[model samples]
Every structure is written in structure tokens, then in C-alpha cells.
Target: MATDDSVHPEARGLEVVIRTAPMPADANGNGDIFGGWILSHMDIAAGVLAAKRAQGRVATVAIDAMTFLKPVYIGDLLSIYGEVVGVGRTSIKVRLETWVERQRRRDGSLTARQSMRVTEGTFVMVAIDEEGRPRVVPEA
Candidate 1:
């Protein structure tokens, strides 16, 4: 999981693939949601894109430059987006971004922004053959 070291705004060319609300059980002692949960969502988003491009099975081989910008809380809506930035013979690099929309406070005032990017990372996915091993990726 990436550390909450820095943050940035959303950009274009990224595909939004996952969105869900955080539950109470998904949080830690600090009441902040876990980072792994967010990362898993991002992986799922990347996997969907990778599988489509690979035209078959694919597995994550590496993750590069993961950075978490903010902490998510319960009742917040989580959204993840990813895009295939690079493609190799058997691997693809997906740039992913995660965001959250927290519910407003009781006073009706804006408790949080509409969409806050929590984390971003580059996930490498390898195209796999029927035997479940790495295989050549088709030309795009």
C-alpha cells in the first residue's frame, strides 16, 4: 500500500471502474479506512482494463510509485480509475487513481469535498495463457 505522502487532482484518460461506500468494519482504530481496501479496488480496476487488452487471463506482476494522499472514513464513497499507459509483449502498465466522496456533516455544511483523490499507483499486469503462465500480448 502507498503512504499518504502527497496528493493531486484528477486527470483525463483514466477510466472509472469501481465505486462503493465504506462501511464501519472497514476502518481502523483511528476511524480511518484501511489503505489495503482502497488498493484492492484499484487492482480490480486495473485488472479489468488489463484483461480486456490482453483478451484473456492476466495477473499483476508489479506495482510502482503508489502514493496515498488522504485518509478515507466510514460512509465515504470510494471510486477508482485506471488506464493502460504502456504495453509490452506480455505486460501492461496501468496508471490508477483512487478518490472518495465523504458524506456531509449534520449541519448540511460541506464536510468534505465531492471527490478527493486518496491514492495513485502504476500496476503492471502480465498477460497469461490458458495454462496460467505469462504469454505474449496482442498488438493493439
Candidate 2:
């Protein structure tokens, strides 16, 4: 698994693909956002990029090298960043990173406003036709 340290600050400015706040229902028993919930968001973000690259529908075929560096709170604003790292005849590999901008405290304190990287993974998506058959990725 790739660690957060593998991500550099300069390269972290990739376009944000998905940004949303997690609800209490998405939290685990420990009051932190569930890992599966984060994975779902990552898939959605990666799919968005994949579809754009494939210029059509795409489906996730695999998730590789996922690493969770920190826990996400329910109130945190989750931001997923993705980019097409590789492309094949019918497959697109997207590198995705999840970050969180924690919500303010009840006391209205202005502290802890910095965003933190929580998780990251590479998603392999394949272009598909209407009948769900693999299609060739168009040349860019």
C-alpha cells in the first residue's frame, strides 16, 4: 500500500473531482467516517475521471494500493481528487486521493481549518458499451 508520504505537496494540487460532507449515518461505531464510505466516494470520483477519459460509460474493475492515513470525521468536508494516470485499449487507471476539511467546533472556534489527506488509491476502470461489453478507449 502506498502511504501518504508518497504524495508530495506540489503534486497535491490536482483538480478536485468530488467534494461532499459525510453524514452521521456514514460514521462507524467509533464516530469516525467508515472506510467503506470513503472507498465509495473514491470510486465515484475515479469513475468521473474515467468516464471523461473513456468518453463514455466506465465501470470499476479493481482498486489497487489503497492506503488510509487518517480517520475522517462525520462533519468533515470530504474532497476527492483524481487524475488519469494511465490508459489502455479499454481500461483507465485513475489515482485518487481523499482529503477532509474538518468542520468547526460547537464553540465557534476558528481552529483546525486546514485540510488533511485521509486516504488514497488507484482505481482501474474499463470502458463499456450499452450491452456491457468492453469497448476500445478512444484516442486522445
Candidate 3:
């Protein structure tokens, strides 16, 4: 995938955990993608990393911080990148960023795609067992 050179320095080298484009159904009446949709995607990406690190099931317990840097429009390819920033006995913290490669009409023609950072958040996930109770996170 093509990347923008202007992305945050800290966002560099993070693993791209999820990449998907939003459909019209994912947008609000104002034609912008819903915040919940983006948040859900972030959560899913965090869960994937957390599960891998935990070596088992994991559940999102909290979103410690989330900032919407820009609006997401339909047809923009959203890519979520994540990394395991912290780990505890039973919880893990994942830092995630969502970037969008956008296509827009310019001068009645499609402009060259440009990538931009849209949202970022830190997700807190807890390792879980088969019964859905918190469990110790295995050592990596």
C-alpha cells in the first residue's frame, strides 16, 4: 500500500493490522463516516494484536484515549496500524492509528490519491479465558 510521507513520526513502522474501505452504509447522513464505525475497527485491530500477544482470547476493556484528527469520507481506504505498547498481568495496551488514502474530484477529474492520518487511540484489552473471565497474559 502507498503511504504518505507526512504521517506522524511516531506512527512510522507500526504494523498494519486492518485495512478496509467504508461503504455508504457506514456513513452518517452528512456523508461522513460514523465515529462508531471507526472506533469499532480500531477495537477490532487492537483485539487482534492483544489476542496474539496473550496467545488466547482477549476483550476490549476500555479506550484510554481517542482523537479524531480528521473526518473520514466514504470510499477512502482506511488502514489501522497498531503496536503493543504495554502489557500487564492481565491487560495489554495497544496504540492504534487510522490513516486514509483518499480519492477526490478536482477540476471535474479524480485527483491523485493522497494519504492522511485521521484518527488515533490507545486501547486497553484484557486477556480472557474460555469462560470470558480475565486471565494472566502469557509472556512473549
Candidate 4:
């Protein structure tokens, strides 16, 4: 999985599910963006896709094969991209990838930036009924 994640560049053509930058409060003791923050965004991205596919409410069932490939900094512009990789009776498996564009210098300019993948994960989202029970995933 590391090889697959490392070989790919920024996810182009795939849907840009969420795009935002980290703040100082989002950083960890090491000065890097906290892993949980990235994981939450990935879940949100996957949920967006999953809900659309299910055409209704959905819940996160599991997060599989989560990988942190690189560190995200406070100023980096984070982009979370998602793709629906699989669908079942009530579950949708989404592949989520996060990339960060870092400012090249202290000038805080976007003109010169570096983009790299920092995290990738597969989130399993399940279509749910109003009662919170698993429901059939509708056909697209």
C-alpha cells in the first residue's frame, strides 16, 4: 500500500472533496498538523461521496488501510480528494487522499509552492435508515 500511495502524484481528475488549510491550533507538539485532523477531513470527504451514492443518510463503519505518507504543516493548503472505489448492499468504500501545498518561503506566497500527498485512507460508509440501521445502497 505504501508503494501504491507513494507512486501516485496529486490526485488529478478525481473529485476534490474538501480543500482547506491547517491553522496553528491544528498543529501537534512536533509543529506538524495533527493526524486526527487529517483523518476527520478524510472521513468528511468520504461521507460526501457516500451520501451522494446512497442518496440518503450514511454512517462511517470503518476506516481501512490508513497511511500517513508525509507531514502536513500549518500553512500548507490541504486538499482532500475522494473516489468511490466499491459499493455493496449497504456499504460504499471510498478512497481518500490528502495533498498539501506548502509555501516555499516565509513570504507566504502561493506563487511558489510544493505539493505532496500526506495521507491516504479507505473509509467504509454504510447507508442507514432513520433508525440508524443499515439500509440498501441505491443504484446510481
Clashes per prediction? Answer: 0, 0, 0, 0
The most accurate candidate by TM-score is 3
Query: 1 or 3: which has the higher lDDT?
Result: 3
> Candidate 4 residues 1-140, lDDT tens each?
34354444443456888999899899887777889999988998999999999999999999988999888887888998878989999999998888887874444445666667889899999999999999999888
Q: What is the lDDT of residue 13 in candidate 4?
A: 52
- Pick out the ten consecutive residues of candidate 1 with the lowest summed lDDT: 1-10
Q: What CA RMSD would you report for each candidate?
A: 3.9, 2.9, 3.8, 2.9
What is the per-residue lDDT of model 3 for residues 10-122, given as tens digits with 9 covering 90 to 100? 45779999999999899888788999999999999999999999999999999999989889987788999989999999999999889898887422357888888899899
Which of candidates 1 and 2 reaches a greater TM-score?
Answer: 2
Which predicted model would earn the best lDDT? 3
Stretches of candidate 2 exceeding 4 Å from the true structure: 1-13, 103-110
TM-scores for every candidate against the unseen true structure: 0.85, 0.87, 0.90, 0.87
| Alpha-carbon shift of residue 17 in model 1 (angstroms) | 0.9
Pairs clashing in candidate 2?
none
Candidate 3 Cα outliers beyond 4 Å, as residue runs: 1-5, 8-11, 105-109
lDDT of each: 0.80, 0.85, 0.88, 0.84
